[model samples]
Target: MSRIEWERIGRERRRVSRWSGGTTAEIAIHPATSQYAARNFAWRVSTATVEAERTDFTPLDGFSRILMVLENELTLHHEGHGTYRLRPYEQNAFEGGWRTSSEGRATDFNLIYDSRLRARMSVLEVPGEAALVAAVGSLPCEEGEHWIHRIWYTAEGSVEAADAGGNALCRLDAGDALLFAVHRSHGEESWSLRNAASGRAVVIESVVFS
Candidate 1:
């Protein structure tokens, strides 16, 4: 997959629960397309929910998923295997249909990717000024790289970002996000998000490419 161009992924203004488990999820690219909706997949921007009492997931037929704990702490127990604990920003990948289990309640992010489109998926956290811009810009520079970049800034202050078009993508206050896409062959973009408040801002971007 190509690098994730500058985009933000964090919290959104929506939430849902699909499977038997009350495992509600917020979406960035909410699988509106036939191929995506039928596959029950999405690029999880940010999520927080109760842990499964038992293994509870709908299981995909032709897809897989990647998960990363954004905040809080939790343990994951894969059926017969031992339990694994994940810290903030830790990542893991598993078959979408694999019967796996969880151990505790915590918040996390997930990248739901189609197996037919790519073999694996990745999730990353970007911090600071220059690095964030470089990481996000890389996605659009590579060939065949296409991505829907979602950014959210939950810091106590305000943050701003721009696209190659020089249009203001987002001017975020606390508990807000700026969502946009970076297509193949897009030109260079610039952004300046500053914390108006005392707290620092957090950025998350999910890239789906091959």
Candidate 2:
């Protein structure tokens, strides 16, 4: 099994729009033709700029959603679910079907996944000159399963991904992302995410298992 197959999604591919108060830049969507306007995607990832002071979130029934603030602060009020206060890098997962509204001027990262898949999202803060390791192994994999994807988004500063041998695999700057597809039969694999910037680097990491 050839592992470590990855793709670098540059800023150019991020389709951005400024026609609304909540301008969004779509990073990627599964199925290649999943329509955001039609809400028919298996999974989708993107960033949104919340310019309005108070914005009502669209109800997306039959989907699970995760939101993380990338800039400024945010407060989410999900009716029937409690309200959540989120700072930069902080996240809250809620049902997309909730009557949700928010108050904040911020930039945020989001993930929406259908019930057919299980997903997890987290943030990695790497101090200057330091590194964090991402390891995938047999624990999460069952007997010969596939369809696992590990995605990394550079939210702040710069980062470098290296293999166990310390050989550089990829370097990502802010607003850029990398996607890795690994088969469970590969047994195990790991990567060291290093802060290649002068200060610190923040990376949004997500794992989707189907």
Candidate 3:
């Protein structure tokens, strides 16, 4: 059987935490654990706002992390890799075990997954209607034996995901998301997203466990 799921997380449903550096607001997580323990989660997505003061990130011994700046700019200093200055929508990937620290204030999105799972994240910016359609049409649809999941998150503006036949799957506004899953299945399936309003829209695409 083929299946797809859509989940809209309002700002209120998100969990906010105050850290020494600043604050972290969770967007969504896999396995749906009740607590925020790293070992209980296979994957996690959240937004962290760093304060001006330098702060060290918690070490996740066996995980990989993708970080993207959504508001303002920040620099991440990795113990061995040097410093990474990220502007709005810029993304960087690093091993969670790396001793990392951040300076400057900025709101950033994060995607963390256990090292056992393969995952990749990219930021997409659609400037106009035509560009939005093209971006949606370019989503990858691969056939494979292993299960593959794709998560589309609207960082700014609004968009809608649909099938090849123009059937609406879901609408995503700023901070909203759509998650699509595919396992061993027959036949081909294609999914795409289009801008819902006139203006630029930013989306974060995450391909997991592929």
Whose TM-score is greatest here? 2
Cα lDDT tens digits for candidate 3, 91-193: 8899999999988788898988888777888877756555344222233445542655667788999887776566776778887877666553434555566
C-alpha lDDT of residue 195 in model 1: 40
Residue-wise lDDT of candidate 2 within 118-194, one digit each (tens)?
88898888878568987754337544446677779999989998876677878999999988777766666667888
C-alpha lDDT values of all predictions: 0.53, 0.83, 0.76
Total clashes for model 2: 0
Whole-model lDDT, model 3? 0.76
Model with the higher lDDT, candidate 2 or 3 = 2
State in Å the error of residue 14, model 3: 1.7
Q: Which stretches of candidate 2 lie over 4 Å from their true place?
A: 18-20, 137-145
The most accurate candidate by lDDT is 2
Please provide TM-scores, in order, for all candidate models, with all chains considered together.
0.68, 0.90, 0.85
lDDT, residue 38, candidate 2: 79
Model 2: how far is 11 from its true place, Å? 1.8
Per-residue CA lDDT of model 1 for 75-127, tens digit only, reads 77655545678877676777777766665667666667666544233332334
Candidates arranged by lDDT, highest first = 2, 3, 1
| lDDT minimum window of 10 residues, candidate 3 | 131-140
Off by over 4 Å in 1: 1-12, 18-21, 30-37, 40-46, 52-54, 79-83, 119-132, 135-137, 140-158, 164-167, 173-175
